[model samples]
Target: METLIVLDLDETLLYAVQNKLERDEDFKMGSYFIYKRPYLDHFLTLLARDFKLAIWSSADDVYVKQLVERIKPAHITFEFVWGRSRTTKKRKSVTDDYYFVKRLSKIKQKGFKLERTLIIDDTAEKSMLNYGNAVQVAEFTGDPVDDELLQLSNYLQTLKDAENVRIIEKRFWRNG
Candidate 1:
């Protein structure tokens, strides 16, 4: 069974240099740019080489696409990038759950189930309370240029072994 790797955009893989929502035609104030955060390329490469990759950010698709292009440059195989347009004040609204759930449900519909699927997100607003197949990486508010990737890396390394997923669940959600 191919594992589905869903990732969040802002603050997970990339930090916004500028408020990404600034480009909104409806924005009365300003927005920013999404910049790559640490462990992004390396982790992405690892996922591409191992599990099937998909991005399920709360942000829109166009914004996510631009970030993907900027980061990978070369086309690394990705299953999908599930996202939505920034048009509301819903805090963490999702417009791509159809794609998100379908991917998982397909595995069930096809008579297969994941031994281990993973999600690396910075917020619980979407993935945590809803998806049982996710690991939330609590957001770190600091200079992006200085944040360390070791914590994320250590967790990823453990995922290579079937027995160590508890580390992911325990650590990711502050899961007590």
Candidate 2:
């Protein structure tokens, strides 16, 4: 079975910059979020070594793909992307990362039993409290250029080394 890693957008992977994109009007002009972090391509490329890279965003597949194009260029592509499913922003207290797992699982069809998949998101609830290889980052809402982006590369690199699903839990899902 292939190991998959489903990534999230918005404040998770990219940051809202340029001031205009944050306002409602900028979205009409196609100005979306920006990457406030570094090592994005480096980490994803490194991750590609061990697992298939797939993207899961609530923003629809077309938009997600377009957004990726801005960064992905020609070197990378998502094995499979699921963005059609309806998903709503959740209250901060909620804990449910598997919210979109069914949709993602449906697309892959055969990988459900693999247990080597991963979800890297910014919300605790978004990762369903750490179910099925989900790993949540502390939320980033204020701006596009946060300091967290600097460490993202190192974090994901470490994740690649933790190959086993059990290791992911023991390493990242430990009690806070």
TM-scores, one per candidate: 0.64, 0.65
Worst 10 residues of 2 by lDDT: 20-29
- Candidate 1 colliding pairs: 18-32, 18-33, 19-31, 19-32, 20-32, 22-31, 60-84
Q: What is the number of backbone collisions in each predicted candidate, taken in the order shown?
A: 7, 3
Q: List the pairs of residues colliding in candidate 2.
A: 96-128, 97-127, 97-128
Supply the TM-score for candidate 1.
Answer: 0.64
Evaluated against the true structure, the overall lDDT of model 2 is 0.57
Top candidate on TM-score is: 2
What's the CA error at residue 125 for candidate 1, in Å?
2.0
lDDT of 2 by residue, 1-26 (tens): 55667778756766555554443321
Q: Relative to the true structure, how large is the alpha-carbon lDDT of every model?
A: 0.54, 0.57
Candidate 1: lDDT over CA atoms?
0.54
Name the 10 consecutive residues with the lowest summed lDDT in model 1: 21-30
